[model samples]
Target: MSGTALLLVLAAAVCHASWNVVAHGVSRIGTPFLWWGAVASAVLWLPVVPFTGGLGGSVGGLALGAGVSAVLHVVYMVVLQRGYAAGSLSTVYATARGTGPAVSAVLAVLLLGERLSALAAIGIAVVVAGVVATGLVDRRPRQAPAPVDGAAAIADGAAAPASTGGASEEPAPRADAAPRRRRRLDPGIAWGLLTGLAIASYTIWDAHALRTWELSPVSFMVGVTAVEVLFYTATLGRRRRELLDVVRAHWPRVLAFGVLSPMSYILVLVAIQTTPVALVAPARETSVVMVAVFGALVLREGSVAKRLTASVVVLGGIALLAL
Candidate 1:
């Protein structure tokens, strides 16, 4: 990455991380929050379309690319929201962000004919390894109690002070619940992986769209976001009341994210215009570390020290990719 591109990507990382934190805060609202944000993005960017010179090439081609990107973005939003609802902010965010660049790198190599340096390959592996390790550690089960021996249990009970009659007895733990708890799916991790795939699809698609159509980034974002809002509204028609509730409660945040999401991606798109997507993809994902930090400091979802360690490893990988 060149100096200017690196700076742009880093700035975009901060914006991306900040908005994701905002999104995770309202993850329970899920698609409602995203739909509103998309609406806000559309409204915010529409006025600037003309100023940005609008679509400068084939209108049909631009619309086609925008449509495809809009669909992929919708998938990304749904999956990311599911991830936030199901897991800790750090783990889910890390996994989703990590998966994007990794998949994007593969697609770029195979379909886009992009090449990577030896250091970049190693960096990508390190990033993938760190993400996998963090996910594994996040999913690790806590130690369950050891079985108590009858003699020991009886002795311990005999030595304990008698409870007062005024005190209410606590309910016994249910043995039957353990199986159900164990069987429950970690939707966050599952959705995080899916979100990565969606991101990779759009990343490659957007790159091709930009290269082929030469559309202004501003106009392209405006068109795609408008379509995404329409798509969300059509699909979520049944949950209009819930969507309204979210909008009434968090309109400010919705607006902020609406602006941040596109601005962040626009920066990445600009970087991609000048640099290889292989390099830009991983560099842009430096946001993984940024979001992990926010997840710890702002959300307090997990161990900050542990998440920071994992993030450092991810940054190391990004640095190598940059080299």
Candidate 2:
């Protein structure tokens, strides 16, 4: 691969992970965030449509493709937000990234009758195992609670209980002071799998639409992002106050997602013109590792070593699939 193309792919991976981090940070606002994202992305990218390739010679197909893609992407965004709310960043991002290509490969085989070599089959298995590993990484056994401060408790005059009808004067415990529970019940993995399914749906339809209509990457992205705005507006028209509040509170994250999300895709598309897709595709999965590491280190939500180890395994499978 050319050095420039490789660099572009790596850059795209960073953008992808960066935007995902942005998404997780503000996902609590839900539809408000999605609405702002659609609007900002469309406005940000609209100007580039003409320069990249206007319509790719098919206005009708562009509408159809963008409409369908909009639906798919909205589903993706909704599910992704829910996943972020439900689980740690590491588990959700790692599992979704790993699962997307696995779902795509399965679809290609089942619908297009594409055959996988032995290596590809093994890659699928490895990906599945790695996804599970990431998902379960946060479900670690709870550490034993710290020993209570007997000296401080005694010095604080626990004898006050005698004044309260002999009721124990133990402090009303802070809400989060309890030992961890329900680690096995975290729904992050399930939500991640759902998000991955949404990713595959959009990826398949978008690929077919772009190739069939010969749409330029820029035009197609602009069209789809525009459609997304319309969809978000139609669905969220009554949420003006909520939307405005999110923008007021988190405009930095909103704009970051707006820029980073599309930039990631556009960079890969541009790189694909010069690099073999086999290389570009696997390079994109590098974000799987970056985000996992981000979650473990920056977010401090899971075991760093466990998430990093699982992310590496996922990337290994991706490399094999690329082969």
Candidate 3:
């Protein structure tokens, strides 16, 4: 990564971690929160789009890039929510994040014609390892319930967002309902893989959009947020009341997520303009360590030694990338 690219991705990481920290209980609220967040993002950032670069390309190109990215991002949320509902949280979260950067790195090299140095490649691998280790920290002997999908979560009173891309803290399924939602044969690995692919797909495609189409990051993201708001609204069905309740009760968090989530991704898009996606992909995983720090310091969670070890490993990997 170029030094500028590195700084941007790290800033993106901090933004990503900050919102995830702020959105602690969003999973319990489900689609309503994401809906509000999307609405807020579009409305909040629309004005800045013109100042940043306006379409920065043809309207057709901007629509294509933003439209496609919106679909992929929504798919990511749906699949990730299902993964939460399909298996253990730790299983889904760890597997998806672990798989995402690896797949993104490989595709960046093979499809995007980006090359990574041997040491940088190793750095990417180490970062993925540390991220998975951090994700794995939530596992318990009794097993937490799988998370609920957005639509289902509306009915069940739970919902989760994507990480890197957004969050996965949907409340565990009700104890009595957990068994039926979980698959005895598959666990969460299947859904996790699907989620991982979705993550990589959007990551690569969004990079392609910014790099190939030359769309302004702000405009593209604003378009994406607008499309997502529509998609979420169409799927809301009879849940309009839920949306209103969330808006009224949690507008602050909705606002925080709206601003930070897109900020995180917009920064990543900018980084990808100057840096190879292979490096930016794994480098973004640094957010996982920041989240661990949040858990230790803010949330007063346990696993201090383990989180510290993971942080050290992730930092070491980052050092390798800088080499």
Highest TM-score scorer: 3
Candidate 1 C-alpha lDDT tens digits along 1-323: 67888788888777776676666545445456657877888888888778776785778877998898877776666565555444544455556767888898899899988888888889888877676555444544322222221111000001111111232366755999878977877665676688778878889999888888887787788788788768767766567788778888999888887788878887887788777777777777656566656656776756788777877787788778666
Q: Per-residue lDDT of 1-323 in model 2, one digit per residue for the tens?
A: 46677678779888887777666645434456767776777788888787788778688888898788877877776676566555554455556766776776676567544566787678666756676576567753322222221111100001000001223467866767554543355566787788778877776676667666777777777777777667666766566678767889889887887787778877876765544343344456667567667868987866898888888787787666556
Residue pairs with clashing backbones, model 1: none
Specify the poorest-scoring 10-residue window by lDDT in model 3.
152-161
lDDT of 3 by residue, 184-237 (tens): 555567887888888899989988988887889999889998998899888877
Give the candidates in order of TM-score, highest first.
Answer: 3, 1, 2
Query: For this target, which candidate reaches the highest lDDT against the unseen true structure?
Result: 3
Worst 10 residues of 1 by lDDT: 153-162
Residue 323, model 3: lDDT of 80
Could you tell which candidate, 1 or 2, scores higher by lDDT?
1
Error of 1 at 156 (Å): 55
Regions more than 4 Å wrong, model 1 = 78-94, 133-137, 140-193, 242-244
Q: lDDT for model 1, please.
A: 0.68
**C-alpha RMSD of each candidate structure in angstroms:** 12.0, 12.1, 6.3
